[model samples]
Target: MHHDLVDGVPVIWTETPGPLEATLMFGCGLKDETFRTLGVTHLVEHLAMSTLPRLHFDHNASVSLSITDFTCTGRPEQVVDFLARVCAALTALPLERIEQEAGVLAAEGSGVADPVTAELLSIRYGTQGLGLASFNGPGADRIPLDAVRETVARHFHAGNAVLALTGPPPEGLRLPLPPGPRTARAPHPAPRTTRSSWHRADVPGPGLLLSCSLDDQAMLLAAHVLSQRLTDTARHQLGLSYDVDGTAVFVGPGRGERSIQLDVREGQEQRVAELLWHEAVRLATEEPTEAELADEREAAREFLTDPRTADLEVAERAADLLFGETHLDGETKLALQAEVTPAQVREAFAAAMETALLLVPCGVERLTLGRPDGSALPAGGCSERTALPVGSQYRPPLLARARSGAARKVRLVVNADGAWWQDEEGLIHGFPFTEVVGVEVQEGGRMLQGLGNCFVPVASELFAGLGRAIATIDAAVPEALCYPASALRATG
Candidate 1:
């Protein structure tokens, strides 16, 4: 293995006794984009590879929260040529294909109907940079050509890129990337809701998803330990879940996101969350046993010593460079893993649990769990809004409001303070008029979503006055909330 620098870009190459593989990584992804320019990076990625479909070798591109990876494998010559073409394509972006690429992304987004990860990001980050992850990048299609060009020029530079090779170095590997300073990781946006708020979604399969950000080595190790405990409880003793796993993503120096996920039967969603949290509380306070920590350390050593594939090793090396981490071989990594103390991991767990976000599959019923003390979410209330304009009012019939799987009929009242809906049991749910997130108009009625993760439906019977109601609500909220991408497409 060897590390070198081509121009200003970092290159990590290794020789393996197998097929040749190469990957080119960039330091910009969804995290680099703002709310208004959400999909600019993805658009650039698609456009860059839009010209490479004819290549026979295995080639693909991936865009993530903080990095973009482009990889190809085949004979050394084919791989090198493909990479050169990718670099050239990025240097001189084909602006003519912007609209075409935008259409592709739009179609993909529409087909998926906003994925869970995007929804989580949106709720966690609001409508800002990292928060834009939850959105479908609605403004992607309208981004101007000049803005796209500028994004490409700034991020697709030698200083902000890494190239990794496994097997022999590809011939004529000329990455004539343009000159630009390395881009810094974007700061996270201020969260919009309670740090430990609960988000619910109905997925094809039911699962309990817990996510939190870890900013140090202790936290990372704690995440691993916590995940291990939760997985054992959820999958082994509980007999409720089919699969459980923990994963980590390092976004920047001493900063990353980690998640503990569990797939379970439909009826056991809440129980799964409860059990997971029970184990989390225990780990946070009791500290991991030395044997357990040693087991984790040994597992790390095994994986590092026996990487499944050469391609994986190269990718990890490149990722380390992208996140400003020093490269470590198997022995060095194992040594570092051993240095993490049980108390440090326990303390990390306690801190992480304080800001944890719980996402469960709550069909129609809202699920709330008692978090550990001192880590409870702060109190919140209905947002403030001016009086509803006179004549901008309606009482719509109840229709099914889409949720996990079930919803109930409700009455919507638009008054001075904002809008409040009465559920089947006559429970009033108030959402400040000014805090409306987006309004989705459907065949039977219009679904109104709020800033605090509430959804209500106004029946089609009120369609006669729905237009007036929408206008009135739009008038009260910020201009951005007036017409969401989904609402605009629906109304148009």
Candidate 2:
């Protein structure tokens, strides 16, 4: 393998005897997008890719929270040529059919369930940079060409990107990209509340999702060992779940999360939940056996050294370069994996439990470790109160859907102060109009969505004067509530 700089961008390549592959990647992604211009990067990528002529090669463009990649696999010259064309397209984006691209993006967004990571990021941070992960990017009707053009000009450049190849470098592999500063990761969102928070995903195969702020390898090994034990207990021994596994993701430097989940039938949620909690507590208290640690280390080594995965490893190295991560070879990584003591792994698990959040099945209740429903928000003590404006309140002959999919009569109380809702469970939810991201109009009514995954739907007729109220509150909301804590702390 060799490293060099081409046209002011870092380029890495390995000489191997096979089909050549190349990837041009950028560090900017959804995290760089503003709340008002969410999905701009994705739209830009789509527009740029749409401009390219078809070539006889495998190619794809992907958008993630922190990176956007354009990769191709084929003959070396062909791949390099394709990438050159891609760079040219990105530089002079054909945003003319942006409306068509937006429609395509909307259809794409609708197919994938909102990632759990986005919600967790929002809860840990806020409706700012990284917290914007919890939101769906720009809607088909909202994103415009200028926004896409600006995002591209700001992010898609030489200094902010990397080029990686699995085979020998090709001749004339020119990346005539504009120079720009490398964008840094979004500042970590400060915690809104003191405790861990839980959210319902309405996903099948419900299980526990945890956001652990632990070091990388430790989190991975701990999750792996715990996953093994839980899988044996839940599936092999008790037959409670058919599958059990754990996944770890790096949310930020030296900070990440591990999610252990189980797929169980309808009747077994509570028992499985109890078993998972028991194992979590046990893992925190006791260390894994030497055999378990050895197995996990071997697994890590295999993943890093496997020849069949050389292309994937090249891609990972390229992405790491963009993100400023230390690049460790297969052997060094294996040694790092081997040096992790059982006690350290146990300590990581124990620490993870301190801020653990559990997602449970809808019917089954009472995970001893989980927070009660709706308790994730601040306890209400409204310092001020205001009644709805005349004719602002209406009792429609029907109900509307909250963000949680629960049915409730749409009752909205809004003033120059803020917005208020009293749910059927007798819990009061409040959002300063400033905190209100946007009001999504639906067939039944208006779903007032807010930060940290909260929503309140008011009947169409009942929210008749809502626009004026929104404007008034929007004007005053800035002064009243600055952060989420302020909004959570004040309401009527």
Candidate 3:
């Protein structure tokens, strides 16, 4: 399902029966108090979700560089009923309450502590008459109830609002039409104008962020190509980071500027920063390898094969559509990606690299790069060496343990599952069938810790649990639990 606001806010919604999921999205070209209002709106969204009765399991929300979305997943039947209630709550949310608005501000402020994240935010934007960080400093949290009320009063104006319903849009769900041509007083537009021009605001933080703008129609196609190439090069080839990806094109006609920014960590900030700059320069000066270009095309094709009924993907795609992105079905992105030549990528890279490069350092007192002025390369080129082959005679077993420290430890095979393990400390751990992949565990050890896998979604939860578990393990023995090869096998 798709709906368009005359004011240019468009929404797309999809519904599926299994494991019900729903997402509410707000597409706005944000600036000034817009982000503050979004912060409040998000808080209200959470409060609204919490108020729903019989809501089970996952309820999440995210505010990104361009869009803010609220999502909830649960039983199908309950979700249908919940959708109506959510719309009602959104329409009726009280933004005039000072206490409520204050709570929202506090929450947004608390989320900004991470150095890496803060740096990303700082560099992706620029301080103009509009200011640097979109959601930065005390003003970000200083929005008053009246300001929020005023913002909300104009927020859901007919042509400026989007309401999407996924998962069996209620048997008889009827959305209320705005009284008239709903339109808000022109708010701030997003920061992208054309493919050739990019804008970013920076604040003090660790690491470096480089942004380059592209022409309008070209930006999306360029991004699809650039993201795939960079990710494959950085992660699969250079082993720079666990992952490297790009943001979907955010600006459109009369929306704002269109740009892409690359983020590098603090420890290797200088080296990575230089590498990124040099790569951009190199790509601009020359063309990508045919293999690199081909790989990007292949990945993009694979990405568009089929859309899972997942709420997050649906919401993102819907938002992209709202922003005037071309809608393609089934591997169209692949064809588009494939059509882009190494020369085109090189040309786009050269054009974008012209944007001003900014640096923000956090946590560290100062940084001294071996090549501070962007000269010199790491001793070895950024190429990854293949992993050493494991001996055929050795097959390691999966190890699970409940550690006493502030780290929640749960070891599971990637794509295979077997038995659950419980430590003497009463911590329950298990590999729930789908965790294992093609890799097999080999040569298990007792005391020594081996870095297995790092998944952000899981790590975030594990660490929280670890913190709590650590406090309880006063004298408990930290057992090293191991699962023999026989213990892991595909389940029927």
Best by lDDT: 2
lDDT of 3 by residue, 381-471 (tens): 1112222112111111222224333222323121112213322333433332232211111232111111111011112222223222222
TM-score rank, highest first?
A: 2, 1, 3
List the global CA lDDT of all models.
0.65, 0.66, 0.40
**Candidate 2, superposed: residue stretches over 4 Å from native:** 110-119, 126-134, 207-215, 240-245, 370-410, 441-447, 461-492
Candidate 1 residues 103-217, lDDT tens each? 7877666411124444555555555555555565345565556668878988888888999888656657678888887776665555565356565665422222234444355
Query: Cα RMSDs of all predictions?
Result: 5.4, 6.7, 19.0
TM-score of 3: 0.57
Candidates sorted by lDDT, best first? 2, 1, 3
- Those runs of model 1 whose alpha carbons end farther than 4 Å from true positions after fitting are 106-118, 139-147, 204-217, 307-310, 323-329, 364-368, 374-394, 397-492
Give the lowest summed-lDDT range of ten residues in model 1.
379-388
lDDT of each residue in 1-492, candidate 2, tens digit only: 678888898988887557887889998777677655777888888888998787777999988767788988898788878888889988898867787787788767632113444454555555665667667633644664567777887789997899989876788888989998887556555545335544454444544445675345666788888888888888899888887866554567756656677787778877886787667767778898889999989888778777877777777788778878777667766777778898988887776766665555566644445332223322112112333333244332344343333335445666655567655544555576666655544444445556544655554544443555445544553321211211111146
What is candidate 3's CA lDDT for residue 242?
A: 53
Which of 1 and 3 is the better model by lDDT? 1
Q: Local error of candidate 3 at 451, Å?
A: 45
At residue 356, give the lDDT of candidate 2: 66
| CA displacement after TM-score superposition, residue 476 of candidate 1 (Å) | 8.4
TM-score of each: 0.77, 0.82, 0.57
